[model samples]
Target chain A: MHGKRVGQWNGERTYLLCVHCHNPHSPRFKPIKPLPPPQRPSEMKR
Target chain B: MSQDPPCTGACSGETAPDPSRRTVVQFLAAGAAVASTGCSLESFFRKSFRELSPAQVRRYIAELEGRYGRKYGKTVTVGTAGPMEGVKFGYGLDLSRCVGCRRCVYACAEENNQSRKNPQIHWIRVLEMDKARGVDVNHSDIYYDAAEVPRPGHFYMPVQCQQCDDPPCVKTCPVGATWKEKDGIVAIDYDWCIGCRCCMAACPTEPGTSTGPSRTSPPPK
Candidate 1:
């Protein structure tokens, strides 16, 4: 069913199914710290 | 000629008669009652983006255009176009060639017209990971700021919306503001969204990736 594939690990991936990139449970991709924006052109090395 | 004494009927009090406090209270109560009723009616009749008819959409767009045009003193055209048919969107990145310059993040933010200040939003995030560990997100750092990018032994991975076949964000939206389009892209209806931040919390990607409208301040009058 679609619900099973909605990142909920109802069961292990079989011949019929492939695994997802993230764990079904607690699937929060947290970074070490908030990313800073791109550097300004003026800040680049000469 | 002798002037007739003026007679005050209700205003005969020693001190000049003042407006009744009860009258003011009643007026305030009536105003509050009407305001709440209007708000509840609006909430009850509010429709989702997908549910809006073409005519309704046009009216909404026109209203927004008028509001923004007045605010910015320019003609603003608020338009909504449906997704093109037969276009299933996807993205791929080659980690081998990435320089970790974060140029893509800037480009994406510009293209999406994301806010640059107060609650800044970016559509793309480039993560710097140690090559020794081999793609461990827990160990990955996106805040790395070295003198130069593509640092000796680190790899870069630019992350964005994955557009999963069954998006967890869609499943977690309490108000049905986000959903997976037929083309596999996850579309979010900002108008319909209540800014509950459920989708943001549910998204497996970066924490602040799927933000709704900011509720901290109201729009300019």
Candidate 2:
């Protein structure tokens, strides 16, 4: 892979992976839970 | 409280005969012991940034670096650099230009040393919104993890801290631990922050907003 390479196919569109883009071993993003809402200061006791 | 000198072991000299004074001293000693076990005793009662002398601030930062370094098993430097004189910091994203690749998301997390384990913290979160709906963020999908992005008629919007002119987060902090700087950046004093997360809730942007795992089932073809 000199500078650009065709990565795995995904549906209809094709994506180009630049030499600087991602690690070949683990390219997918990890899902994160949204930060939880804050409770009232009084609720902290519970 | 300001008038009283910080309690020391030998501070009970003349007050030794008073029963109430003895009780108060005993209570303070117990509180100190608990705080010392939590973190450095000095840090627990550290003064606000405005109250600290320059030397005190430097020593405080050094102590933080040492403690965090030991915890993470690597040396880390905590900087107290202030913002530029007149420059204000703001973020702008061009929906037309973004491809929803999520490179920015990962880069921010790694750079900030956010936990990659449970309850990860990602400062930037990109949402895939329907172009037909214009800029309706309430309907935007943040958990969209298609194998490829720039999907069909959807537009991308990257959301982070907006640092509003009248930031609700700053107002919501019970203690004055969080504040907006002159340059329009909202900052939290971690040392003083009770971790109440009122600011997190007050922010217009959703918390824990980050690129998430791919859907288990494939999208309908």
TM-score of chain B of each: 0.61, 0.62
Best by lDDT: 2
Candidate 2 ranges beyond 4 A from true positions: A1-46, B1-39, B42-83, B209-221
What does candidate 1's lDDT look like per residue over A3-41, in tens digits? 133433335553322134445456532333223654443
Model 1, span B1-221: residue lDDT tens: 12222334644766543345545554576567757767653454453113756666677788889899999999888758776687677756667656778777866666666655455556777878889999888898767877666677888888888887888888989888788878777788776777787776777776454464433333434
Each candidate's TM vs. the true structure? Answer: 0.53, 0.53
Residue pairs in candidate 1 whose N, alpha carbon or C atoms collide under 3 angstroms: none
Number of the top DockQ candidate: 2
Docking class of 2: incorrect
User: How do the residues A1-46 of candidate 2 rate in per-residue lDDT, one tens digit apiece?
Assistant: 4333355433354445443566745864443343322222343331
Docking class of 1: incorrect
Give the worst 10-residue stretch by lDDT in candidate 2 chain B.
B209-218
**In order, what lDDT does every prediction score?**
0.65, 0.66
Task: Report how far off residue B208 is in candidate 2 (Å).
Answer: 3.0
